[model samples]
Target: MSSAMDIPKGRASYKKKDGILTLTDDRTFLIWSPMPANGPPTVSLALDKILNLKQTPDTSPKVILKIIEKPKNPDEQEGQSFMFQFTSPTDARTEANALRDLLSQLLAEIRGGDPNVPKPLGAAGGPSAAGGPPPNAKPPSNRWYDDDSLKADTQLQQSLLDKDLELAKTHAQALALKSDSISDESFNKQFWSSRVGLLRAHAFEQHQKKGSYNVLSTVKPRAENGEFKLSLSPEQIQSILHQHPLVRRIYNENVPKLSEPEFWSRFFLSKLAKQLRGERITDVDNSDPLFDRYLGADNSLGVASKITAAQHVPHIIDLEGNEENQGGFKSGNRKDAEMRPRANIPIIKTLNSLSEKIMADVAPADLEPSGTPESGAKSFDDARVFNQLSLQDLHGEREAGSIRLNVKDQTKFFSNHGDGISGEDAQIYAQQNPEDVLFEVVADLDTFDDDGAGGIDLRKSIGVDDDSESDHYEDATMSGIQKTPHVGSRAARRAAEQQILEGLRKARAEHAGGPTGANAVEASPMGIPPDLTERCYLTQMTTTEFLKQFWSAFLSSSSSGDSSEGGSAAAAAAAAAGELAYHVESLKRCVERIEAIAAEAERDRLRAAEARKKQIQEHYQKTGKKLKWVPPKGGRDSVMALFEHTTAAIEKAVALYRGSRG
Candidate 1:
C-alpha cells in the first residue's frame, strides 16, 4: 500500500487507514485512500486554504476540516468551502488534537500573525481544556474567510487605499498632458531638438576611428601565389575618394573604359599612387599610361597652396610663412643630407588637401571663429599663444616667488659631517690624497746616483745586497725551521714605512688648515640682499607687463592696415607709438636696475674679500700657522652677465621700432 501511495522517501505518514495521510514540506495536506471500483482515490489540499478545523469527542474521534477551494473562473466568488472528515478511534483523538494545533500554527504563520492566538474554530472545537463545539451550534459566518477586518487593522487598509488613489491620480495627470495626436512636424522638431547628444556621441565615435589607419598607406597590392591582388573595403574606397579628389576624378573618367578591377590594378602601379602615398617617384618607377596624364592635375588646381593659405596658425609656428620671409632659401636648396626632399610638389599638395578635408570633417561645427573682423582678423595672434610660444607666464606678476633658502652657518654647508669633520673621515681623506707620497717617491728617485753598469745600483743605495739577504734568510730558516719568508732588510722596510707615515701626517696637516678646515676664515655672504632681490623681481614683472601691452598694440596697429587709409588707422598708429615709447622706457629702467644690482653685488664681493683677508691674518697670528688661501677668481658677477643680453634685446627692439616708424 505504501508503494502504491507513492509516498516520498523521508516524509512520515501521520495516519494510515484504507490509505495514508501526509503533510509535505511545502505545507500541502495529502491524502491517499483506496478508491471505489469506478472513482479515483487521492485528495490534496494546501494548509493555507483551510478555513476551519474541528475534532469530534466520540470514541472514534472524527476530525472534520472545512477548506476553501480554488474557483474555476477568476471572476467567480473565492473561498468556496469543502468539508473533509477523517475517522479512526482510540489513538486518533490525540493525533487529531496534535494535528489541529499544528495546522493552526502553520495557518497563522502563512496568514501573518502570532501562532499562539486562538484558532478560528469555536471554544468547544479547540484542543484546550475547553471542549469541541456543540453539534447544533451554527458556523460563525459564511464570509469569515473573505473578511479582511479579521486579519488587519482598518487604519492600515485606509492608508494603503489612499496611497493607491494618489498614484492613480498622478498617472492620470501625466496622461492628460500627453497629446493625443503626433504630427510629422512635431515629431521632427522633437527629434532634432534632442539630437545634440546623439551627434556628440557619433562625432566621438568617428574621431576614435580616424587615426586607426591611413587610407592611402594601407592600400597596397599583395603578391599571392603566381599572382598580384589588391582588395579594398567599401569604407576604404570611400575614404580614398574623399581624401584624393584628383584620383576620384580620374577614376570617374576612366572606370567606364576599364573595369573596376583593371582600373584599380593600373592605379596601384601608377606614379600618381606613389606620390599620393608620399613616396619618392623617379622616372624608373612603373607608370600607367592612362593615369600618368593626371599627375599634373592637382598642381593645376593649386589645392595645396589654397589649403596652406586657409590655415589660421600663429606667425611663430608658421614655417611656410617664415620660409617665404627668408626669400624661400630653404625651399630652393637641397643641402640637408639626412632628410632629402622626397615629396614633390604634387605630393605636398595632395597631403595638404587631405589634411584640410580630414580636419573639416572632424572639427566641431559650433566652434567660434579664431579671427574676427573687428580684431583686425589677426587669427591666432592672441596673448595666450604668444605667452605659450615664448614660455612666459600669462599672469607672472600674480604668482608668488619661491622662498629663499637662508643657511646661517656657512661652515656646515660644505662639511662632510653634519656638524664637523670626523677623525676617521679625516684619516681616510689623508690616505686618499696621494700628492705628498708621489712627491716623496719622486725626490728619492732623483737622489739615486748612476752605477758603473747601465742601470743604477738600487740595492747599494738602499744598503741591502741580494746575496747576503738571501743567505741570512736561508740560515735563519735552517736554524729555526721557520716558514716565514724574507721580504727585505729591516732598516730599509722601516725607512719606507717611516716615509709613508710622514707623508700621511703632512697630508692631514694640510687638510686641517685648508679652506674647508674648522678654523678657516668664512667668505663674505654671496647672495643678493632681500630688498634688492624684491626690487629686481618688481622691475622684471613691470617690464613683462609692458612687453605684453606693447606687442598687443603693435600687432593691432600692423594688422589694422596702412595709417594713410583712415582716421581710425592714424589713431591706432598714434596709440601704438605711445605703447612703443612706454615699452622702451620700461626696458631702459629694467636694464638700469640690472646694472645697479650688479654694481652693488661687485662692491659686496670686494668688501667680503678684504674682510676675509684681514680674518686670515688674524687667524695666522692666533694659531701661529699660515692657512692655505685661494683668492676668488675674477669674472663678471652672475648678476651682470644678464645685463648684456638685456641691453642687446632693448637695442634690437628700439631699432625695430624706428624702422617701423620710418
Candidate 2:
C-alpha cells in the first residue's frame, strides 16, 4: 500500500485528438508496484508529464477513436485508459521496459495459488488488450481460430491457421520447458526405456557373438539320423539352426515382425504326425530280440558291440543240372543256360540341328519388290541400314515420314553457353525476341538542295570531271562575281544587283548581241542589290519544288519546238531518263562510306561491350555473384540498333553549312 500510494494523484486524462497528456486535472496514480529481492521497493509515479508526445497524431499509439460525450454520472467518470495501446515511438525505451518489469513482478506474486493475490486488470474492468491473457491462449481447435471480427484468422489468413504454424511454436515452447524440468517420474520412464534398449542391444550382441543363433522361443526341428536316434539340447539345436543357410535366411526374413516366443515355436521345434515327439529314430524299440544272436549277459554293452549283426540274413539258393557250366564261385551245383542272340537294327535319326549343313544345301530366291525404292545401297551386305536422325525430332515420336534424307550424319551446334542448339531452335528461340535487333539501313544522297524551283544537280555533288566544252549551251547567259570583300565596300552586293538590271536593259536595247546573250556584273542601272542571296544563305531551292517548276517550263518550251521533241529531246525528259547518270553513282559511293562509318561505330560499340563484359566477368570471378546464369544457346539478331542521335546532329550541321552559300 505504501508503494502504491507513492504514485502521483491525477485525473489521468488523455487528449481526445492525439492522446497527449494535457495534465487537465493531475489525478494520475499507480495501482501496484514491484518489490525486488534484497532491494528497496520501486516507487511508481503516474505523472501527467506528456514527456514524449508525437508532433503528429499518426505517431501516437493507436487507441479507440473517442466520439462519445462525457458520462452523466459525475462521480463515476473514467475514460477508457490506453493501457492496451503501445506507447508513442518517441517514448523512452527505459520507461517502457520499467513498466513491463513492474507488471511481471505483480504477475509473479499473484500467480502459483497465492491466496493474497489482487484481481487481474481485466477482471476488475471489462478487459485490457495488453493486460489480459492473449485471446488466442485458450482457443478451441476449430472455431476459436475462425473468428471474423478478430484479425487472427479471416479467410485471408485461414491458410496460416490450417498450417498450425503458431500451434507448432507453442508446442515447441512447451517441449523446451518440459525438457528443462526435472522429476522422478521422468527419470523412471527414462530408466525403463534405457533398460529395454539395453536388453535388445544385448540380445543382438549375443546373436552376433555366436555367429548365428535363434533368440525366438521356437521348437527343435526333427531330422533323420540313419536308423538310430540322435538329438541335441535346445541351445545346440539353436546353434545348428542359426548356422543352417536356409533356416538363418528364414529367420532374417521374418525376425523384424516376429515376437520372441512365436518365432521359435513355429520354425524350430515343429512336430510331425505319426511320430514320437523330438525323436530322431524310426527303428523298432525291441533291440534286444533284433540283436539276440550277439547279446551277452550284459545286454547293453553286447548290443552296442554287435551293431553290424543287424545285416545278417537266413536264406540261400542252389542250382543243379546235368553237364552244368561251373563258375569259379561254385563247382558242386551248376546249370547251363541256353544262349539267344539279340537283334540290332539301324536307326533313322531325326536331324536336331542343320546349321552349316542346311545353308550349304539351300539358298533363298528373290521375293517381290516392296515398291519402296531401294537407294544408297551399293552391295548386298551394306550394313548401314538404319537412317540417322536428330534426337529432338524423335524424342516422343515413333517414326518420321519416310522421305530420303540428304545427310546421314549427326551434327552438334553450340553457343557462348554450354547448352547445344542442335536439331531444333526451340530451346534457343525462347531466350530472345526478334524486335530487339537492328533492321533498317541508313539512307544516303549525293547532294541536298533547298529551292522551290528544280535546280541543276551540283557538279561538285556528283564529283564532276573537267570538260570545258561550252558549245552545249547556245546564247546561254552566265554570271560570275568575286565575293572576297568588295574593295569599294559601299554595299557591293547592291551594285551587283544594279549591274544585273543594267545588263538586262542594255541587252534589250541591242547594246549586247541579243537578249539571248544576257549577262551582268557588279552593277545595275538602278543599283537595287539582291538582298536575299547575301542576307540569307541558300545552297539551292528546295529540290522537290524546283523539280516541278523546271520540268513544267522545260516541257512547255520543248513542246513549242516539236511535239516528239518534248518527250524525247526535252531537258526534263533527259534528266528523268538519266537519273542513274546524274546522282546514282555518287549516292552509291556515299552509301558505302556511310555504311563503313556505321560498321566502325558498331565495332566501337562491340569493343566497349566486350570491355564491360570483362569487367563483369572479373567481378563475378572475385565475388562469385551467385546468380551467374548460363545464357541459353541462341538469340534472334546478334546486333541491336542504337540510334546514337549523333547522325541526326551531323545531318543538321551539313544542312547548316550548305545554307550559308548563296
Candidate 3:
C-alpha cells in the first residue's frame, strides 16, 4: 500500500475530454482534448512564443503552464497560462524551472539572441526566464539525497551513460553497413572483427542450442546411438502417437493389431527378446572336445571373476542384515536354516571324505613353505586378501561421497550422528527400488570424430542417401521460401521470355560477324588465328542465299576461260568451293554429335529433376498435404530454343553446300 506522499513524480491521469498530451520533436508541445463531430481541440503554444515564466509551489505537486506571449493564432490569448495536471505527483517548482529554461533557449534562437543570457522579469517580478537562481542563492536545508549518496548516484549514472554511448556506436556501425553507407570490406575489417560480431555469434550459438531450425546440424538424432534421443514414458509415447506428426506416421504404418502400450513396449525394447535368444553358431566343432571345453570354461570364469573383492564381499555376507546380526534369526517367511545344522550331517560327511581324498593325493614336501621373511622385516598387506568392508565402510568409498575428516583436528566434538544406511545397504535398496535412480547426463568433451580416429571417413555416420530428405527439411524450414516480385506471375513470365529472346538476338548478331568457311583462316578479334581456335564456325546465311553466291563466282571464272590466267582462276574457284563444301560437311557432323551429347545431357537432367519431384510427391502423399511450388518454365524453354537454333543453322549450312555442288 503506497501513501499519497509515496506517489512517483511526473505521473498524471487525463480526463475523458482530454484526448492526449503529446510532446513531439516537430518543434511543438500541445495538450489535446476531444471534440464531438469535429477535430480535436488543441491547446498548443509554439516554442518560440514562450517569453516569461513563473513557479507556484503553493499548489503542492500539481503545476500550471504559464506563458507571457501567445502564438499568432486567433483563438489563443496573450499572457495567459493554462492548468495541466500530470498523471503522477511532481515537483511544481522543478517542472516550472525546466520549462522556463527550454522556452528561454527556444525564444533566444528565434529572436537571434544569446540563449544563455537571463531574461528580464515580468510585471509580477517572478523568476527570470533563464530558470537559474538569483545571485548569492542559498541551498535548501532539506534535500532528497545526502552528499555521499548523490556522488554515488552520479557515478552510477556516468557509468550507464558510458555504456549507452558504446552501444550507440556499435549500433551506428551496424546500421551504416545495413544502409550501405560503409563498404563491406571496411565494416568487416573494423567493426566485424570487434566485440559486436563476437556477441552476435555467441547469441546465434545459444539460439541454435535451444532448438532452432538448424536442427539437422545440431540435433543429430539417432534412436539407437545418435547424439540425441527422446526419452518418453508410455503416456508420453501415447500422446505423441496421437498428436506428434512423425510419431503418428510411424504408428499408422505399422502395428495395426497391437494396442498402444504393447506397440510402444515393443518399440522401446524390441531387441530384448532377440538378445535373450542368442545367435546360433553355424559351425559346430566336434573335433578337439577338450579344447572346446577349455574355451567355454575360460569364458565363464572371465565373466564370473569381474566382481571385485569389495563387490564380492557383499554377496558372501548379508552386510545389510549384519547390522546387529539380524540375519542370525529367521526373517519374513523363512525359518532359521543355520539353527538346524544337525540336519546336514550327511553333507558334512561327504565334505570330510572329499577333503581326505585331496590330502592323500598331495606330496607333503611340495606343500611346505618355500621361503619366509626375516623376523624383523615388515610384510605388505595385500588388499585383495585383507579387505573386510563393513556396511559403514562401503558407504563412503566412492569419490566425493565421503565426509573427509581433517587430520590436523585432534579434538573430537560430536552429537548423535550415525552413518545412516551404509553403502552396502544403500546398494541393496537401490537394486530393489531401481525406478528412483537417476543418471547424470554428461557431455563427451572429445570433439575429434570417433570414426576418423579409427582411419574411417566420419561422413559415413551421416548417410547422405538416407538423410538427404531430413537435411532438405531442415534447410527449407530454416531458410524458407520467400515470395519475390519476379516469380510465377504472368507478367514475370512475359518479362523473362522477353529477356531470353533479347539475349538470343544479341548472340545471333555476334555470330553473324564471326569468321566462317574461308574467312575462318583469318585472325580473330583477339589476334588469334581461326586455325588455332578450339571450334569451327558454321555459316550464318540461309541455304538458298549461300548457293546463289557460290555459283555466281564459279560462272564468272568459267566465262574468262579464253584468257591464259582463266585456267588458274577456274582452278582457285573450284578449290575454294570444294574446300568450303568439305568444311560444311565436317561442321554438319560436328553439329550432329554436339546435339546428340546435349540431348543426352538434357535427358539426364530431366530424369534427375523428375526423381526429385517424385520424392517430394511421395513425401507429400505420406504427410497427406499439398504445397505450392514455382519453377522457371520460361528459362528452361529459352535454353531449349538456343539448342534448336544452333542445330537449324548447321543444317542450313549443310543444305547450302549440297545446292552449290549441283
User: Model 3, 412-492: lDDT tens per residue?
Assistant: 543223346678986787677434343221222133236645654444423233333334434444687554442333444
- How high a TM-score does candidate 2 get? 0.12
* Tens digit of per-residue lDDT, candidate 2, span 255-298: 54774345544433332110112133234523322122221211
Worst 10-residue lDDT window, candidate 3: 297-306
Runs of candidate 1 with Cα error greater than 4 angstroms are 1-213, 282-284, 299-312, 328-366, 373-381, 388-662
Cα lDDT of model 1 by residue, 1-662, tens digit: 32233323111122242333445444445333232211122344555445555545555434554456545476867556644454444454444555555666667665432222444555435344556555234345422233332223333333333555543343233233323353333322332232334333333443364342358888899899978889877567756765676876776577548876787888888898887787778989996789788776662231223223233455666666887877684546546676655546656666665665665434232212333222344644454456656744554566677898888888865765543767898778767758887899989987876687766777666556656534555576669876555445654466789999997864453333233435331221124444544444455544444444445556666777564466777777776676566556656666676677777766765776787788889999999878777654212354443344555766777677777879
Better of 1 and 3 by TM-score: 1
Candidate 3 Cα lDDT to native: 0.39
Alpha-carbon error at 616 in model 1, in Å?
78
Against the true structure, whose lDDT is highest? Answer: 1
lDDT of each: 0.53, 0.32, 0.39
TM-score leader: 1
- The lDDT of model 2 is 0.32
